[model samples]
Target: MKISTETRMGRNRRNPREERSSFLILCEGPTEKGYFTGMRSRRGPQLDVDIPKGDHISAVREAVSRVSAEYDAVWCVLDTELDKMLTASMLRAAQGSSVELGLSTPSFEFWLILHHAKYTKPFQSADDAKKMLKKISPFWSEGNTRFSDFADKVDSAYARAQQISPDGKNPMLNPSTSVWRLVASIQGRPEAIGRSTGAGRS
Candidate 1:
């Protein structure tokens, strides 16, 4: 039997109890928020992505405080380079809670960069990732329109991400990101997803 694209893509396959399941994504930056929002528009009506007004840790704390039954999943999309101490605190704060962390090492731009190519080199800073991205696309700083252009390539990016970390551990080790796992979850492939806790600085 041939499977439909929706079935192969894992869309609209939630269980009866999870029929009303929805997601709440707390983004650390506007770009992250816009990225998730673009995916939401293409995916369906089960997501609400927001960019809280604060630093990464504070925003994570804010997300933790707002977790309720209304949301079946709460995710915080953060860059691991924000601050070592703050990232540590954010991980601790999310422990035992429903808040899942989707971390990109060096920066979230690394995840975006993955859409264009497979990158394994470590970045010293988020700026480094941005610089490399600019080399691939001259108008890299254009904004959400740029992100939407590559949103459909998320699965390719996710596949490339898997090649970097086979054990699914320590994603903060420079050129790595757990963002693909979160993207998988958002795409309705929950089995391909993994939480971003215990991913420490390397």
Candidate 2:
């Protein structure tokens, strides 16, 4: 059998601009890690996950320390949970660094909830967000939900999240999330950043 050059190279040929970028995602929760892990497996991005101890601020500090370690980018998946003071501190910590944040108000579950429905109601606590998410996705459980659970709805969730807030500038904003930015990066659609519009089908 004869083999063509296209078959040999397959779909591995990426332009200079399309070259795969490496990422270091820092988060504390298992659920966030699980979802990003699933994305890494499927999306083919050069990514690494780091679970740091302590609060979201610590995660930002960790990202700051690691951002210069040769990775193309570094991000923190954090739940601000209506704590403006803490959120402000975190933002301050990341200001001079290349550390990006996938911030969700009340909890990361709210970001997941966007996958199923459009909601903008503020939750007082992480538990409140989790309870609401359970009502929407009855099967959702912390640390166990994988990307495949709602893989097909990524574009929808991205659109819904974009509708809620335009960017990561306001982590203190209630019921808001910038997780869509991280999702866009993982999808190799970094141009989607700050785009408050259309849904890009992944």
Q: How badly does each model clash, as a count of residue pairs? A: 0, 1
For 105-186, candidate 2 gives per-residue lDDT tens digits of 8788988999999998778798999999899988888879799998999988999988878655667778888888888877
TM-score of 2: 0.83
- Candidate 1: give the clashing pairs: none
- How much does candidate 1 score in TM-score? 0.80
- Candidate 1 has an lDDT of 0.73
lDDT of each: 0.73, 0.79
Clashes of 2: 1
Off by over 4 Å in 2: 1-19, 193-202
Encode model 1's per-residue lDDT on 1-202: one tens digit a residue. 8889977668756665455457888987767876777775533547888888878778778888989988877888888784567667768777767687877787888888888899988788888888897897676663544457786787888888767865446746778888776776667676645543432321
